[model samples]
Target: MSGAGNGFPVPDERQLDLERLDLERLARLRAQLVAHDCAAGLFYDPTNIRYATGTSNMQVYGLHNPCRYVFVPAEGPTVLFDFAGCAHLSAGRSAVGEVRPAVSWYHFIVGERVAEKAALWAEEIAELMARHGGGERRLAVDRLDPAGLRALEARGIAVADGQEVANQARKIKTPQEVLAVRAAVDGCETAIGRMAAALAPGITEQALWSHLHQANIELGGEWIETRLLTSGPRTNPWYQECSGRVIEAGDIVAFDTDLIGLHGYSADLSRTWVAGERPAGDAQRRLYAAAFEQVTRNIPLFRPGVSFGEIAARAQRPPERYRGLPGAALAHGIGLCNEYPLIVDPSAWEAGGVEGRVEAGMVFCVEAFAGEPGGREGVKLEQQILVTETGPELLSARLDETLL
Candidate 1:
């Protein structure tokens, strides 16, 4: 399957080093802000903050506290409001033009100072906006504290949903972004390969799950998104997290690697396995076959000019026996996290999926699950794909031959 038989012109074969805040990416994001008619963009979401300024401080801590933020004006310099006295964290590392200390105790339970902190945070934001000519223009914020919102309203700065603007900006992958995601996938594949080798009977699900976490941390990745490793009957309904249950022989084990890897890019991949050295049972084999078919069959449906609805219509859905399983969408876009364009079956297209055409440089994860109602175990498979001008290009590594 080469040449124009797939679709449009094939993209160039170029490689790039993963620089999280390359100049081009920053410029493109700022351009998107301007295009959205935003005077300035303020981000409290950790991912959005990093995307805007290429700086992250106490990210997990900041998720609950709105003290860390990034501000990007439509035509001026970028700024990072650091948490507490951590302004030095982003001084020379990020592309941001300015770094300021803006501390807030929004998550603290020490009396009512949280609201006072929020007001202070809002006042600092107002001052920043005024310095950047955003006083009379609208400010878009991805997440805001209630008190901060009130203060913004008092200051007469119209606040819009910055998450929408950020999502649209991030929907398309720049060359460097694609490269970073590929690097993240490479790291995840390495970790998964190690896990594959370590899989065996009598190993606790927690032990196996720890291998992935350890490997990811050693490889400089951020925390994983979920604890989705389980064995045997626990694998049936799909939302089970890893536990202390010892994996028995002939049991089915499944895991989803919703990992945030190198450079803050996400690599979402899933694999299922049999615990014993012996081959998978007939029913397990059938389930695996169905899941594999679902992933491989629907990949080509994603390409430039293909509408999400059409892809949903043509996608291979879960088998009838597994119709009641927990899966909701057949495929979805992936970037810093599971981003956009959840492609569903035609029956669910209007309800769950968005209406838009796939374009070049969009990355997606085609997901599939198969398990009977009240069954013992389930099979899950996922593939990371890049929608190129020509067709869908697989970014994830192939499953181990033994698993097939």
Candidate 2:
């Protein structure tokens, strides 16, 4: 367990703050991009940029200064959209010289000094990239935004999507990546405990969620959206909750959330419980039992080399059908975003889903849902998992078989 005996290094408390990111791994990534025809990767995705450069502090103020960008030109140095009050990024810098610092190639069309500066800055950045041996080759953008993308095309510049290049790189997580996921799971368990203690029959669903939000922030949750606490009949496929709805004695309180740790690792999980003391009501009991069955009995099919299509085939609705959400797949992969390439649904594979084999260090969440369609109750449960040579390791260990 110490050093790399387990083939993974566990960092101490101070080290867990994201001090040791793998720069060599990043070098290989850059080499891969260079090998490909990609030049000037315009990074718009926050997590994508963070994974490559090891800094999301610039995006902490996403709403106002939402126009942060990072560019690693094929033959040129790396560049970013420089901002005020961003000294924290340099102080907490991860891979020091790996990311060559340059400023603002793309500009935001909105906000103060945004539109005016964006055009000028974009021109300046383009010139810098060209001067640094960047040929007139096509540049890649992540999303298919026709405006910015087309505008560049109008200027006779070839544009590529950054996502196309990134997807293949992030699929297979390294050993260090697995450790970060485990740390995120630990933080999520603590947050869940605080939320559960705050739940009560008379308390509103919103109030329960408020407790979770406050606890997560207090405990250093980097960015958690939708601390979804769906209850009673509101628990179909909707992934949000309102505190206005009071928890009835027999209601099924489903706790679901998507979270990011301080280290930029993500873990999305859901746990449903029937609120009662010694005697859990009939509908509530059924929901809990079904949810338990999914997480305990059915969820373990997510092993290395196992195809998602194969897992979906196991969930056929019949005599041996798995019970959870009516049309929900078993789960999905949790990374920079709550949702990404890998999904637990069997049909997802039918759609040409992820084909990369799950390696020893891949981190994912095994989401399990149980509820009768058109029925008045529902249940959903999820846990963070890190795949290893031995098997799947549970990251969130606070999860209990039954409600507290």
TM-score to true structure, per model: 0.92, 0.81
In candidate 1, the residue pairs with backbone N, CA or C atoms under 3 Å apart (3 or more residues apart, or in different chains) clash, namely none
Candidate 2 ranges with C-alpha deviation above 4 Å:
1-12, 15-19, 22-25, 58-66, 74-76, 84-88, 92-121, 131-136, 154-156, 237-240, 315-327, 347-356
Residue-level lDDT tens digits of model 2 in 73-100: 6654556554555645655455433333
Candidate 1 residue runs with Cα over 4 Å from true position: 1-20, 105-110, 400-404
Q: What is the C-alpha RMSD of each candidate to the true structure, in Å?
A: 5.6, 5.3
Top model by lDDT, which number?
1
Total clashes in model 2, counting residue pairs 3 or more apart in sequence or in different chains: 14
Candidate 1 Cα deviation (angstroms), residue 171: 1.1
lDDT, each prediction: 0.80, 0.61
Prediction 1 global C-alpha lDDT: 0.80
Model 1: per-residue Cα lDDT at residue 268: 94
